[model samples]
Target: MSRILVVEDNIGIRNVLEKTLKMKGYDVFSVGTGENAVRLFTSDIFDLVITDLRLPKMDGLEVLKKVKKISSTTIVIIMTAYGTIENAIEAMKSGAYDYILKPFSLEEIEIKVEKALSQQRISNENIILKEEIKSRFGWITGKSQKAQKVYKFIKKVSDRPTPVLILGESGTGKELVAREIHENSSRRNFPFVAVNCAALAEGVLESELFGHERGAFTGAHAQKKGRFEIADKGTLFLDEIGDLPLNTQVKLLRFLQEKSFERVGGTNTLKVDARIIAATNKDLKEAIKNKSFREDLFYRLNVITMTLPPLRERREDIPELIDHFWSRYTKELHKDMAITPEVKDILYSYDWPGNIRELENAIERIIVLSEDKVVSIDDLPMELREGISDIIPKALPDNIGFTERVEYFERDIIKQALEKCSYNQIKTSERLKLNRGTLQYKMKKYNLYCKKISTKS
Candidate 1:
C-alpha cells in the first residue's frame, strides 16, 4: 500500500481528506502543520504529501522544499483556494506534483492522489531496474592481476565526477565496465545514455551529442535531446570515442571545460551536469598523432584511463565466465543445459579474439540449439572447435556392461570436479550442475572421497 500524508490546517478538511483517502486504500497520516509533516517524514517515509498552501507556521511551499530535500523522488501535492492559485503554480515550480483547489470533491481528492501515487510507483520501479542493472553487468570477476586493478579503480572513482576514458580492443567489455561504474555511482538512479561516436556522420554525431532543434537540419522534424541533456545528473558514455570527427571533438572539449552547450540551431547557452565516460577500440594516442583525434579533448577525457585486458590475457577466468553465461542462458531459455568436459576443454583452449562478448554469444548459441541437456564437443560451433585438432578419447578399462560404463564416466567427471573445487562438495555440485544430495549419493556409491584435498577457495 502507498503511504500518504495529509497536511491541512482546517481540522474538518483534514479529517474528510484523511477518511476519503483511507477509503481509497492508502496509508493516510494526517498533520495540521507542515512542521509536523516534516517531523513525521524524518522518522518515516511517505509516498506522497498533500498540504494546503496557507498554514499557521510553515507554508505548503516550504514543506514541499523540505520534503524534496529529505527525498528527491517523493511526490508533493499542494492544496490551495482560487485566491492562492498563483501560489499553487509557484508550488508546482518548487516541485509539487499537482495542486487541488479548496471546496474540492472527494472524487477530486481520489483522482489526484491516485495519479500522484501512480507516478511514484513508476519512479520506484526505475530505481529497482537500476539496481538489477548494477548486479547484472556490474560484476567483473577474474583472478588475473589486471582484472583486480580494474576493480580497484572502479571503487576509487565511482563517486567522483571525473572524466573516464576506457581503452580496450573490441568485445573487451569496455561498455560493461562503464555501466558498472555508473550503476555503482551516485547517479545510479539516473540515466546512463550511450552513443557510438563512430556510427554517425560528423554533423549527425554533433546533433546526437548536443541535441538539435526542430528545423535545425534536413530531417530534424522535431526537437530532440541529445545524449548529454538526456544524461544530465547521470552519465553519458561515448562509445568508440576515437572515431569522433575533429569538429565534434572540439565541442566535447568545450563541454568538458565549461559544462555548457547549445542546441544545433538555438543561441541560448544550456548547461547540464552529466559525467562523460568514453570507450574506444582504436588507439586514441595514435589517432592523435595521425591528426584524426584532438590532443586537447584526449587530455580532458583521459583524466582516469582504464584499459581492459583481452580475454586471452585472463585465460584462468574462461571456465568461470563460461559457467556464468551457461547458467544465464539456460535459465533464460528454459533449458537444462550442461557441457561435457571435452567441450569445456575446447572452449578454454581457444583464444577468444572477440573477448567476453564472443564467449558469451558462443555459450548462448550452444544452449539454444543443443538437442540434448548435455553439450558435447560435437555440439560446439564449428569455428570454435576448428582450432582443437581432436579431443582424444579418454582410455578406460573394458566395460562389462552399459551400466558399468555409465558409472565409470560419471565417477571420472565427478572426480575432476572435486579436484577443481578443492573437494568442496557444494562448489563441486554447483560447477557440475548437480544438486548437493545427488552428488553426495554418487560420491558414496563410487567411494570417491578425498581426505587429502583442502576445501578452500
Candidate 2:
C-alpha cells in the first residue's frame, strides 16, 4: 500500500482528510505541525506528503524543502486558503506536486491525491522497465562484489553530461557497458548511435562521423548527417576509439570541447548536444605513449572510465549466463532442449578466451543443431571437446584407489552439472542418469546442498 503523510494545523480538517484517505485503503499518517511532519518523515518512508501552506512553526514551503532533501522521490502537495494563491505558487516553485485550496470538497482532495499517486507509480514503473532492459541486453551480468562495484560506478557517471571511456579486452563487452550507461541516463529516450573506428579507413571514418555535403567527394552524391548529428540530444558510442586516426581525433576533440562541428566541404558549423561514450579494446595509455593517439583528445574522452572483467575471471557467472541464453534462444529457435551434465562439465573446465560473445554463439549453435530434447557432449563443437581433453592429465597417482578416484570425478561432474543447471534437481538428475532421490543423496553426501540454490523454477 502507498503511504501518505497529512500535515494540517486544523484538527477538524486533519481528521476528515485522514479518515477519508484511510477509508480509501491508503496507509495514512496525520500530524498537526510542520515540525512533526518533518520528524515523521525522517523516521519512516512516506510515498506522498500533503501539507498546509500556513503552519505554526515551519511553513509548508519549508517542510517541502526539508522532505525533498530527505528523499527527492517523495511526492509533496501543498494546501492553502483562498487568499494565499501567491504562497501556493511559491510552494510549487519549491517543488510541490500540486496545491489544494481551502473549503475544497473531500472528493476534490481525494481526486488530487489519486492523481499524484498515479503519477508517482508511473514514474517508478518507468524506472524499473529501464533497469530491466539494461540488464537484459547490456551484457554485463553478475551480482558479485566486483560486478556490483562496477554497476555502482556506472550509475554514478551515467547522469553526468560528459564523455565516458570504457577499457577492456576485445570480447569483454565494453560496448554493452556503454549501452547500459546510456540506457540508464537522461539520454535514454534519444538515439544511442555507435560507430566502429577500427573498421573504417581515415577518410571513410571522417566522412562517417562528420557527414559530407552533396558533391563534396567522389561518392558524396547526396548530403548526409554524421553520426554525431544523428545522435544530437542523445548519446554517440564510438567503438574502438583507440584506432581513430590522428587527424580525426583532433576533430573529435574539438567537438567534445565545444559541441560543434563542420561536415566535409561545408564551412558552416553544426552544433550538437550529444553525450560521447567511447570504448576501446586496445591499451590507450600505451597508444598515447607511442604517439599513435592524441593525448588531448584522450583526456577529454576519459572523463569517466569503466573496465569490464573478462569471462575467464568471472567463471562463476557462466552458469547463470547459460541459463539466461537458454531462456532467450529456446524461444527464438522453438526448442525445448537443455544442456546435459557432460556438456556443462566441459564448458566450466574450459577457459573462455572469447568471453561472453563466444559463449552466446556456442549456445545458439547448440540450440540450432541439437536434435534431441537435451544437449550432450556430442552437440558441442569439436574444438571445445578437444580443449577439455587437452587440459586433463591422463595418469593418476598409483597410491590412489581406482574407486576413490572415480568417486572424485563423479563429484566434480555432478557439481559442474548442478551449477550449469542452476541447481534444478530434476534436470540435474536427468542429465546424470540418477533418480531425483539418488541425486539428492549424493548432493548431501558431497555437501553441495549447503550452497544456496535459486528457486526460480
Candidate 3:
C-alpha cells in the first residue's frame, strides 16, 4: 500500500485530508506541525509527503528539505495559498514534487498524490534497471592472466574520458569490455549509446552520427538528434568501426579532432562531449594500408587500445565460461539440466573460432532442447562432437558402480586440466576453479601422478 504523510497546522483541514486519503485506500498519517511530520518521517518511511506552506516552529519548505536530505527519492508535495505561491515554487526547486493550493478540491489533491506516486514508481523502477545493468555487464569474469590484465586496464581507464579502441576477433566480447568500462566509469549514470558503423548505408551513416536537419533529404522531414548528441556527457560505442566508408571516415576524423560536427546539409556546427569507444573485428591497419580506413582516425582512436584474446587462446578459462553460460541459460530456460563430464571434455577441447559468443550460444541451445537432467554428447552440436568422439577412452571398468564411476570420471577431468596447464598445480587448480590444497588432495587420492599422462595435447 502507498503511504502518505499529511502536515497541516489546521486541525480541521488535517482531519479532512486524513479521512479523504484513507477513504481513497492510502495509509495516511496526519500531523499538526512540520516538526511532528519530520519527526515521524525520520522514524518511518512514507511514499508521499503533503505539507502546508505555513507551519509553526518549522515551515513546510523546511520539512521538505529535511525529508529530502534523509531520502532524496521521497516525494514531497507543497500546499500553499496564492499569496505564498512563490514559496511553493522555491520548494519545488528544492525537490518538491508538486504544489496544491489552499483552496484546492479533494479531487485536485488526490490527483496530485496519484501523480507523485506514479512518478516515484517510475523512479524506483529505473533504480532497479540501473542496478540490473551494473550486475549483468559491470564485471568481466575470468581468472586467466590475459583476463586479469583486461580487468586492470578497465579499472585504470574508467575514470578518464579518452577514446578507447577495442580490437578483437568477432564474438570476443569487445562491446562487453566497453560496457564494463562505461559501467565502472564516473559517467556510469549517463547514457551508453552504441551504433553499428557497418550496418547502415553510407548515406544513412552520416545522418546517424551527426543527425539531419529538417528537409535535409526526401525522407528527413524532421530534425533528428544523432548518437553523438544523444550520448552527450556519456559514452558512445561505435561497433564494427573498421567497415566505415571513406566519406564517413573523414567526417568521423573531423569529429575526433574538433569534438564538433555539422548536420548533413546544415551549416551550423554542433559540439558534443561524448566519450568515444570503438570496436572492430577487421584488421584496421590493413584496411588503412588498402586506403579503406583513415590512418589519422586510426591514431586518434588508438589512444587507449584494449585487445581481447580469443577463446582458443584463453583455453584455461573455457570450463568456467561454460559454467557461466550454463548457469545463466538453465535459469532462463527453466531447465534442470546437468552437463556430463564427457560433454565438458568435448567442449573444452573444441577450438571456438567464433570465440565466447559461439560457446555461449551452444550452451543456451543445449539447455533449450534438453529434456533430461543429464546433458550427454548427443545433446551437443554435431560439429562440436566430431573429430573428438574418441576424446576420453572407454576404459571405465564394467564392474564399477555409479559411485566408483563418478570417482573415475572426476579423476580424468582433473588429469586433463593438469595436462592442459603443463602439470602446473597452481594453474591447474585455477583452471579447474579449485584451491591448490584441494586439488593436491584430490590428485593424491586419485593417484594422478602414479601413471604417466597419455599422449594427448
Which one is best on TM-score?
A: 3
Of models 1 and 3, which has the larger TM-score? 3
In model 3, which residue pairs have backbone atoms overlapping below 3 Å?
none
Q: 2 or 3, which is superior by lDDT?
A: 3
For model 1 the TM-score comes to 0.59
What local lDDT does model 2 show for residue 454?
84
Tell how far residue 75 is off in model 3, in angstroms: 18
| Minimal lDDT window, size 10, model 1 | 131-140
- Give the poorly placed runs of model 2, Cα more than 4 Å off: 1-140, 390-457
Give one digit per residue, the lDDT tens place, for model 2 in 1-457. Answer: 9999999999999999999999999999999999999999999999999999999979899999999999999999999999999989988998999998888999999999999999999999888666545544326567555577778988899999978988877777777788888878988889989999999999989999999899899989999999999999899999999899999998999998889999998988999999999999888889999999988898898778888887777776777777887777897788888887667767766777888778878888989988999787788888787876533335568899989889777777788778766899997887568899989998988888646668999
Lowest-sum lDDT 10-residue window in model 3: 131-140
Q: How close to the true structure is residue 371 of candidate 1, measured as C-alpha lDDT?
A: 92
CA deviation > 4 Å runs, candidate 1: 1-139, 390-457
Model 3's alpha-carbon lDDT is 0.87
Best by lDDT: 3
How close to the true structure is residue 252 of candidate 3, measured as C-alpha lDDT? 84
RMSD of each: 12.6, 14.3, 8.3
